[model samples]
Target: MSPHAELVSRLRAAWLSGKTRPMEYRLAQLEALGRFLDEKKQDILEATAADMRKPPFEVEVSELSICRSELNHTLNNLGAWMKDKHVEKNWATQLDSAFIRKDPYGVVLIIGPWNYPINLLLVPLIGAIAAGNCVVMKPSEITRNVERLVAETLPRYLDEDCFAVVTAGVEETTRLLENKFDYIFFTGSPSVGRIVMTAAAKHLTPVTLELGGKNPCYVSDSCNVQNVARRVAWGRFFNAGQTCVAPDYVLCSVEMQEKLLPALREAITEFYSPNPRESPDFGRIVGDRQFQRVQALLHSGHTAIGGQTDAGERYIAPTVLVEVQQDDPVMQEEIFGPILPILTVASVDDAIAFINARERPLVLYVFSSRKEVVKRVLERTSSGGFCANDTIMHMTIPSLPFGGIGQSGLGRYHGRSSFETFSHQRSALLRGAGRETLNTPRYPPYAPHRLPLLRAATETKRRATCLLL
Candidate 1:
């Protein structure tokens, strides 16, 4: 038997004991998680830096801080979130209690990606725990140090019986996925998402695939060039552009593209020094393989701004490519690196058509001074999320749901959405035991006299008040 089989059995036994059901128990585990983040601050920073040279500030904000925010938000709202939500009743069971029981799926599996390893892994763990499920967390082997840290340290803080950290490579992970899980949450590429989904189909287990895609950013000529450039640059280059929601390519008119080129150069220079390789603020690509993949994409178009590379260091300077062909290799896949490409469109209609023709992105960005332009694009396109006048900031808000449509991804989770994604809303109703007359409508013996009584008691009004919720 595989090593994880024993581990799965242990968690399943714990979950079956009903130990994870109490609100107090869930709170304690979540609080212990917050302590893990607080105590492991330095460890997390060092681990990510060792793995990818992620800048300290970037780790703190994008990785550590984001996870902390999720933990605290879940802690604050878990009480209300776990309570039985009373739903409106129809005429049939007016006296009966109707509610949605916020029940937890038994034991779940969460697979994290190498990029933003801590954030991606822990964010879903927080939700699974908040929803009162026992979880097995799998950190990516690609980020060795982060994986080691999580495997070694996280279990120390939380209850061992309810949670576990599984460290596995590609083959072991394939073997590991064969076991049954109540639910599975995966974060990575769409190709792997398909594999995970296929594995889940064997057990008929429900899954939330938080996959990545080539997100697009549209720049209208009406916007301020400098502001638009800075926001787009930040979104594209943050974490060295390993971001799943980073603006993959820029779509604008020739005039706007010309204006954006100089402004983007200025923004890149200001964010990272002119010599980005030496700058502490900038980060290196995670691995030699990833470095090679990103370096090859530079061949897509002539480098417009920066294209310097040091293979030994796995460092690629913040790069912007222009005159890029629609069929180029860089445009063919998500540029999960410090590379940005610009492609000119004749008009908004053309831009929308171009985007619509391809797979829907994780998030679609539009920068325009005209509200109608933003509104028009918003109305026309579809993505997991949308941001007007900015890029990636929409995801920082916990109130908003984050996921993709069609090929991009399959589920949404952030704050409340996270809780909802992990939770199973079980419909519940309690009727008085003595309601024999009321129970008769749902039972056998059909008669004319009972028809009017059944209709009055059970049949709902055709057009009642429209519930805004």
Candidate 2:
């Protein structure tokens, strides 16, 4: 049998045996998982570097830090997050306690993505574990080293009955989805997300999709163009532009694009030196396939500056493309590489119109000091979230909901959102005989006197307080 199928069967058997029932055991497993990650920090970094040529420092800051912090957050908050919540009762049900019980959706599946592999996989795992659900984690096969590390390392530290990692490509994923899971958390492209959702619909399994979109950065005339260039350059080229929330493209006036490009070049030189390939601060495209994809996008347009490539090293220089039309392929898709396509527009209003025309992005960034212009953009455009005078910084805050909308993707997860995603809040109420007075009116013995009384009692008003059962 296939490895994915076997893993599913093992998880199913574990669920049947009730291995996920004990809260103490679940918490222990979570703590162990964190400890295991801490113990194997070097191994995680090595594997990530092997997969993407990612720098050691980046592995620490982007992947490991997020993983450790989230695990820590879960460890510190799990008990409280798991505690049953008491809700206020209304007069109709005042005799009984009204509470919200958060129950696990058993046997969850987590499909992790290639970018930030460890963090993407483990964040959802923390949620599923905290919510008391057995998890089947599928690390992205594109990142082979990290996938191997996860499949090998996770089982050693976690209870095989409660948490297991399945590593495979599309065929195995096809087979894995055949067996029903109560919940699935997927992070990837919009194209694959649709397939995941379609398969999930067959089982009616609840899903949380963390997907990507053509995230836009809008530069205005009011801001400091140099500072704007610095932040935008950092966000665009960070992770080799492989981040899902990376500013996919920029919209600004032709004059502004010209103004920003020189500053951006300066910023790039400051961050990674003029020879970025030789600089330790810069990273390469993830793999051959991604390298080729980004390289092809470079050929699609007029390159204003730094159109350099080395396929053998999987390196593309920090690129700036000008005279880029909206119809260009680079502008059409999520340019998940170091290429920054600058689309020139007349004004901020024109930029807003351009943004509103496309699928709503995951995060919208507007760099401007004018409060009225910022407010106008905020009121006009719809995104999963937005950041003012910045790019991709909103994602760093754990309090904000991070997920796409419409064609970009669906559902949000991070911090408390992650806990809520994995657990179903079941509303339950207990009532006593005193509330029985409310029930007698429904035993219809049609009469005129009863109509007036029923209308007076049941009529809902804007200023009236209501009770429930």
Candidate 3:
């Protein structure tokens, strides 16, 4: 058998046993996962740091804490989330019990990304486990240290029968996708997302793709320059600009761009110090190839600030580029590095036009103290999410859904959205044996008199609701 075939078969058998269906079973498993996090905290920090020089604070906030929040939130709410949601009924089903049952999609595959490996892998896993599905989680092989750590450690805490973590590189991952899954949740680039989707199409399997695109940050002239610079710098430079939701590039008027350049430099210095390479808080690109790709993008426009690169360490200092054009290399793709390109627009309309001209981003950012400008940008452009005066802080809210639209990605997951994504909503209605008399309106006897009763029985219109036949 193929590498994945046997594993899929094993998980499928476990799922068929119906052991994962009970609320108690799910809670127990989730609690075990929480224990894993608490026990493995130091190891995770070390692994991420070894893999990409991910700062300890960054790992704590983005990796460890986000996951714990997801875990605790799931633990606190799983009972309620699993309960059948009773929905309102039409006249035809008024006497019946009608509800939407959230059910697991049998065996599922969760493919994680390199950036924020722990959070991305486990957050979705939390939902899948809560929804009671046997899951096979594949963390990105790019972050080798973390991948190895997860492969070695994660399965010990959870029931080995219900959940398993697999480590695979590009070829192995492609082979793994050949096997069928009830649902596939992929977090990666758009190109790989297409491949996963195409593979899923053979089985007509459902998929949720969390993809990345060129997220544009539009800075209005009315905004505070320092605030905008600091916020954008934080979002873009976090994870060394490897974040999917990070601001890809900036759009502002020439005047604002000029005013913002010095401020951005000051923000970078404040956050990472004058010598970012020496700063412990700064991170390196995940891999040498990624470093080279990001390094090449620096030439897209004149370097306005720090553009230092150290190939040996795979480190690129927090850099800013001004006089960038729409057709520049930096604007051509998602800049997943510590390089920020500023392109000037004539006005907010021009900025909106520039944004609309390209594919929809994962998120659209507009920094303006004025409500009208913020509202105008929110109304005109299309993106997965929006932040008025901030950056990635919007994603910190568990209540909000984090996903994309169009080229950015498909479907959403976070908090309740995560649970909903992994679950299949099964609509059901129960009728009592005594209710047969109420079904007399249909009876398959085609007649003019029956039409009125049938309409009355099924009426759902606000002004014309009828509860009797």
Candidate 4:
């Protein structure tokens, strides 16, 4: 039998046996999982590097550190998060006490993307475990090294009956999704997200899709040009710009574009040196298919600086293209590689209009010194998140919910948001036996005389509680 099938059977048996009922047991499992990752840090980093040619430090910083932080934060806050929160009770329901109870959904499926495999997978896993739900983690098969490690190491460190790793390509995922799940959490492209949602519709499973769109970075005239370039350069080429939240394209005035491109080129040279492919810090496109796709994008533009390639090595240099039009193929889809296309606009309003015409993005970055302009952009454009005078740093804030809107994706999850997403907020109301004054009028008889009393009672606040003398 397949590994996924075996895992499903085992988890189903455990679920039927009621072994996953207690919150204490689930919390214990979460604590153990965190420790497992802590102990296997080196192994995890090495595996991720082998699969994606990522530098060890990059793997540690971008993937491992974030995962550890998320796990630790969830562990620290789980007790408080699980406690029923008290809410203000209305006069209409004044006789009752109101609070929200967090309940676990039965089984969940987390479909992680290839980029930042460990971060996307482990962070969501933290939520599912914290919320006391059994999980089926389908790590991207494209990250072969990390997938192998997760499939092998997880069972050793975690409760096999509570969490399982299902490793396969499309066919395995298809068969697995055929089974009913309480929730589905997916992070990848919108194209694939549509398919996931359509499949999920079969079972009416709630879905959390963290999908990607072309996240645009706008460079305004009032901004510090050099700082904007440095930030954009880092975001554009990080993870070879395979990041879903990476700045896909740039919009600026003619003067800003001219000044910005050179600054960006300088930043790239400083960050990765002239020969980026040979630099240990730089990354490559994941495979030949990605390399070809990026190469095709380069062919569509007037290359301003550094349009070079090494197909055999899967290397595409940090490139900058200028004078790109709205109709260019590079503009047609997401350029998920180390390529930056500068689209010039006359004014910020024009830039806003251009962005508004397309699908809402995952993030909109505004590099402007003027607070009013930044505020206007934020008000006008609807992205999952925004950053001013910077790019991608908004994702670092654990307080902010990180996800997308419209074509970018649906639902948000991070820290408290993740806990809420994984858990169902069931509400309850309890009343005392003696406080029956409000209930008497609300029951059976709909009298004209009782209407004024009900209205007056609801409009006013309750007085202080007093004990009988």
User: What's model 2's overall lDDT?
Assistant: 0.84
Model 4 agreement with the true structure over 300-367: per-residue lDDT tens digits = 66999889999988889989998788899999998889889999999999999999999999999998
The CA lDDT of each predicted structure is 0.92, 0.84, 0.92, 0.86
For model 4, give the 10-residue run with minimal summed lDDT: 1-10
* Tens digits of lDDT, candidate 1, 271-335: 88788888898898999999999999999988999999999999999999999999999999988
Q: Model 1: residues >4 Å from true position, as ranges?
A: 464-469
Q: Estimate, for each residue in 234-305, the C-alpha lDDT of model 2 and write its tens digit.
A: 898988889888888888987887789889989989988888989887788888988888899997668876
C-alpha positional error of residue 318 in candidate 3 after TM-score superposition, expressed in Å: 0.7
Candidate 4 to native Cα RMSD, angstroms: 4.6
Clash totals in order: 0, 0, 0, 0
Q: Give the runs in model 4 whose Cα sits over 4 Å from its true position.
A: 1-6, 9-23, 432-448, 451-469
Residues forming the 10-long window of minimal summed lDDT in candidate 1: 437-446
Native-to-model Cα distance after best TM-score fit, residue 440 in candidate 2, in Å: 3.7
> What's the lDDT for residue 228 in model 2?
95
Model 2: lDDT of residue 42:
92
- Which TM-score value belongs to model 1? 0.97
Give TM-scores for every candidate, taking all chains together and pairing residue i with residue i. Answer: 0.97, 0.93, 0.97, 0.93
